[model samples]
Target: MITYVYLVCKSLSLLFSSSALDTSIITYDQTHLKTPRFPLTDLELASLYENWLVGHGKTYNAAGEKERRFEIFKDNLRFIEEHNSVNRSYKVGLNRFADLTNEEYRSMFLSGTMKRVKLNRMPGRNNSNRYVVRVGETLPKRVDWRERGAVNSVKDQGQCGKSICVFMCLFVSFIFLLVEGINQIVTGNLVSLSEQELVDCDRSWNKGCNGGNVDYGFRFIINNGGIDTEKDYPYRGVDGTCDQNRRNRRVVSIDGYEDVPANDENSLKKAVANQPVSVAIESSGRDFQLYQSGVFTGSCGTSLDHAVVVVGYGSENGIDYWIVRNSWGPNWGEK
Candidate 1:
């Protein structure tokens, strides 16, 4: 039950949206967080909870006793929440879990894997940076004196009868409120994106993942020391010479090949129409290659002068690849 609640709270935003809710978007800057920003109906929250966990890796475990397991799992969830929100240095205490019944949720707090841990040394900086000074010292407070505690207060320690659930609900609710407030204050419009779009936005924001050369168009924006072809061939220029010249740089993508001779066999356009928007067409060297593989992993063309994400994918000659979307114009590269 605790696991269900945790999952529900996490997945609620994925299931449904009002126009206001749908418009909510989470940007991926390191300073920006990615939590649901709106309230969800019970059913919508439940559906998202069930599907996302199943999709990710928190499935039911079969190795442990049914009754003893959920408590441990719930403890794990509590630990993670506390670690992220309250305890910084604490490693996540629970990973493995078994399927549990509702009775397990009620009766499983027995063998005590769930106790509040008072951390002496805080791990990293919390969202805030002001340090409390003592007398004339300039250093921040020592870990031993920082005085942080879990949500469980004194009255909570000796509680009984639905007390645990009440505390659990309160803790989760507080996190929801905090995250939503942060989202409303900092995140941009997300309603314009569907699930797949959200995923793409995240990928694009990954700094290390931009592994290919920058196209001349993109280079204009980031060509710090002019073109370093050895390290910068695979990328497309974004805010470069063209933009400065008051001309829209020619954008190259599978979308512009309307008059090009398509094999009618494997085509990038077909890939996009079929798969999730996460698939895309990528350019290989000066040539074109289809990048139809699904999200997370797919092959870009070899010896790639530049690499771009395929927002969609399909097949040609039974060869599967992606339909890459690039910032470069139609005249920039191959069809």
Candidate 2:
């Protein structure tokens, strides 16, 4: 026997406006009712639970804690199943982050270490030193550095507070590949830069593992000649010695970096069109933690806590969004 679940809540419309949850926008035929799968046996649930625990690297200090975490994991799995049953435009599923509470998820994956960038008004430009725009020029509809093979694969920060370093490394790597004329079709010779090198060595005004700023990282890159490749200085998720011998493995260098005017999306768009721009945004909200695929129309503030890279931007289903490259691994969102 098949069972169907219908979501008819009015609040759901407001909660997921981008999803077009309102019946007015979606006709009766457009609404999809998912058929329920066969219920798992107790033995099956136990096996799945063990696999999930191992897959997510979950652990407990005591028997009581383990029991509590197991219940939480089961609840999360049920939530995923129910959420998937709804007639939403996007899909949601269980991943490494499924079992975590909202706070735990934010602290582990979404926590950022970005420092506010002080912008200086240029004499002849529109506040920014690098980005210049004409009065009535047509901007591209979409610009993805990933499509052009300039951007690297999404990396996982893995509980380390080195988001700032990861953002800096990704932005610099994109710029380096762009300058080198490497494209999607010809990426065999492209090199991935090391974020661990910055984490270990660049300690002028930034703290390793704890937190840091991208502005200081950019300065370090310029002064230290260049950054080493990831193969030469692998990330250990902790701070270590800056290998003097491996300093010769520098693969990418940047003279400097410019920040777009604060809270100015237009200036940021221009910057991203040229290259992947290092950016910081509020990422500690529940909606952000639960974000699946689709344009993120969630309640994101302008606190600027976590650092990320804006690789591209475009409008989807009339909702405009910045294509942010996160450091929370590929399993967390649209990889």
Candidate 3:
């Protein structure tokens, strides 16, 4: 579910996802720009895989796992080679996820209660957006909250758990804390809020590590009188016993959250321009998994399975693009 809110300001209804332009917004559809490429020989593939293993410092704990991963690595290597070989708007490269098959990647990151629990259980499809642009509302040609010291540093949700919703929801809250300058985030003093607070404490309509909802997490923070700082509560990745003492050390809070009107790109920009907006997206496609850099003119699906923050939007080389703040650490995304 795509959720929106601000540090006591306006919020847009666009789902977790793009661009600066004339008042009228143009939604971009994914285009497949594949090029046939020669495959690497088995010997060459093995060599590259060995080099990748050394660079990434990877080792399999169990027998047969290394060999099993090797095949998947080769396929991903071919994909990266093919994508980089072509003249596409965006590019693909091997990342920390290079060794996992596309199915494994999606199931681990995109499945479970973190994403859509069931099609019928999806939230806010019929809800109205909170922010709407006037016919002649003026917007900046570009909006980057990072430059304004609103967005926090990139982070990685270790593979110990599947609480992506926890990371994304807290990330948005962190940004709002920054934007509101709550405790000096705007003065070059950044803070990492505790995602584990929501992961462990917020059990209403959410599971701890298996999966969770961003909206429900926010409500937990609000009712709890705000969340604890990461320094106090910290993230353990896995679900653990809730520490009420740490949970009571409230740090920041938001009044409420709203949904960005589904499929409304225009309203999304408005929300992002005012303040970073949390978005839900379908990040299960293979193309998205290997995305390296450049503007992502997506051919990805619309399953709304993953969440991220849209920090800003602008036009690049005449093509408008959104700057998404992903939680896969600094190694991933077009940051």
Candidate 4:
């Protein structure tokens, strides 16, 4: 009877425990229990990737402009933080911008505030009109709204007159921002090329105040991976890496000049392929040039002993600098 009573008590205890568990516990389906991966648009993903490499609180110059520190846009901050590798020791670098082309950037920019406008020549009686060229929806583009003036008829002007007028009024400020963005893209904010500095380089005989530095200023980055180099005149490298036309060939190490135009036909074009352009403070007699004869295009710099392409150029505080292109990934240099 005692044993039977003990068994009854144990059964009661067991029943009570089961009842308590059922009341306190909550059940979730597999679909509900699993955490869903956050979906980021391409822009968000790119920004996140850039932030992860550039740094959480880092700031960069917008081209070569001063008095401005471009902040890392916050389109996808939270999502980036989740995927950022905690084990990595280095930050994202600016080099990623070097290999990026204007077309590729345009795709990203299209997602942002890029705008297009039609322009024409003023009927100089000798020159004709040019078609529509998309302008970035930003200050600099608006500021220097008339840099390469392409005239339009009153009717063709459409409703953009008021907006165009506004941009024309703020040309200087917009130019400064444009240069700043270019500089940021080039040097990764490690260096800045200021407007004043560019002017100084243009005016001074020694360029960078005798430093032998010439500013290329900021330009719109263009993408060109799809084009066949050999088939194309300007872009003639095997992988469309560099221009081919003798006239369009980039002048590597303008042996004795500064601010040489990319399309300068007078400039000696390199006939050889894969020639690296070298940076020399004094135009050192080094064979390795920083810019390749037909390997790549765009502004770049290099040392006599070590030649590298000037993927980007900018100015800072009345000084100019170059953004060298490298094959390394984001963590390797400027992100």
Top candidate on lDDT is 3
For residues 1-335, what per-residue lDDT tens digits would candidate 1 score against the true structure?
01100000110100010111111111112222133423445554444344434532454456664335444434433433343343211122111211223234324321122332232232321222122223554321111100121111111111223423332322222222222222223442111111111111222321111211112112222222121211112222121121221121212111100111133322323322322111112222110111111111222322212222222332333333332332222211122
Q: Which candidate, 1 or 4, would have the higher lDDT against the true structure?
A: 1
lDDT of 3 by residue, 1-335 (tens): 11111110122221112121111111111221223235656775676667667756789999899999988987887777766666766656665578888888776555423443342334323245556778898878888776777666544554445445444443334443333433333345656787667777877756776555555665676677887788888767677798989988987765555666666678877877777767656577676776655666655445566666777777656666666666664334443
RMSD for each model, in Å, please? 27.0, 8.6, 8.5, 28.9
In terms of lDDT, model 2 sits at 0.54
lDDT of each: 0.23, 0.54, 0.59, 0.21
Q: Native-vs-model 4 lDDT? A: 0.21
TM-score of 4: 0.17
TM-score of each: 0.16, 0.71, 0.76, 0.17
Per-residue CA lDDT of model 4 for 220-307, tens digit only, reads 1111111111122321101112222322322111111122223221120120011112221211111111111111112222222111
Candidate 3 overall lDDT versus native: 0.59
What does candidate 4 score in Cα RMSD to the true structure? 28.9
Q: Model 3, which residues run further than 4 Å from truth? A: 1-43, 112-130, 159-189
Deviation (Å) of 221 in candidate 4? 22
Highest TM-score model number: 3
